[model samples]
Target: MTGEPSSMFEAIYAGAEAGEAKPPWDYGAPRPQLVEWAEARDLAGGGREALVVGCGYGADAEFLALLGFRTTGFDFAPTAIAAARRMYPASKVNYLVADVLDLPRKWQRRFDLVVESLTVQSMPPEQHTAAAQNIAALVAPEGTLLVLATTRDEGSEVKGPPWPLTRAELEEFASGGLILRGVERIESGTWWRAELSRGAGGSTSHARQF
Candidate 1:
């Protein structure tokens, strides 16, 4: 039998049902830094497909769809997915209730861009490595994996629905044999965004210069 619903999940479902939903991490818009990086690039053009992991209420997914990418969004919580669907009834985004860990092997290397935002840090400590592998597998050859995550330098242990990541933890993608192309830190004097990527070949790379 499935385990009883967690309090966090229950709250999300109730909020959705009551029309009072608000994601804790909701920034009211696609993270401004992400918007800048994505818009500056030539990634989303001419009907490309992009995948969004941990799409809470479809804010980012909505923006991607408007930008011309056929977007698909996944979140583990059903309530959030429902709200997202209603919020974008005419949207082409294929929002679904699915856990990142439970993603099928057949989905490997399937997207032109894998846009992950804070999803990796939400996992339990022991699951971090596997999560990296999953994210890497979703990116096609020559495709870009634009990641936006929080980095902690204090070596603090994370007890959370949002586990903080460190530089060392970010490097775990290389262990899965991904070639990091670049990493850029987005500091708006408020939040930090670490954007990491991997090339098709097996070589680790960084792009902190952006």
Candidate 2:
């Protein structure tokens, strides 16, 4: 999320344009965890607004839209947004180019559900705090924030475009009035899945799952 944002994303999309294989995180489908969550909840009511951060091909965003949420997916790369729109021409999801660290002011607390899947890990360590703050800021009061990221053991020396996040680092998202509802290690411990809510009153309402 730091550095010259355009340069970082331009180089990435440029590689894709050159016929290189898509990045590892570009799974070409909605993330399984998101699918599961959607199936478990009544999110298809057409009454909620959802935002997917760094939404590469907008698969997840499109999925949310299909399920009746007014979904918007954004990425730092304009190429990615264009590709997403083209890929899902019939999709109701709104695809746009936007930065997580410097989001539009009107978007502040505008979504009912904010999803950050693998986006935090894509940035350098120095940008994690700012990225977390900005991401949390997008959640409306009582909205849910779902995060899925690669996880690393404490003190592990892993070099990466995706510097795997530690458990403690993920907890930092709980700052700025977001309450941690739960954290789970999934996919054979390679990923950390967290669900947080924005509100002062504590409740365990999210414990239900299908």
Best by TM-score: 2
Clashing pairs in 1: 179-198, 179-203, 180-205, 182-206, 182-207, 183-206, 183-207
lDDT tens digits, residues 1-210, model 2?
346656777667768878986766777889998888777675663568989999988989988888878999999988899889889888888899998888999998788788899888888888998898899888877788989998999899877677889998899888777778889898999999898887633333442221
TM-score of each: 0.83, 0.89
Question: Which runs in model 1 stand beyond 4 Å of their true positions?
Answer: 1-7, 19-21, 175-177, 188-210
Q: lDDT per prediction?
A: 0.71, 0.83
lDDT of 1 by residue, 1-210 (tens): 143333466476557578775556877677776788776774454587788998988889888888888888988887778878997889899998888788977767777677888888877767888887788777655556777777766577766767777777776664354555556655742234444444544234432212
Against the true structure, candidate 2 has what lDDT? Answer: 0.83
State the local distance difference test value for candidate 1: 0.71
**Candidate 2 off by > 4 Å:** 1-6, 200-210
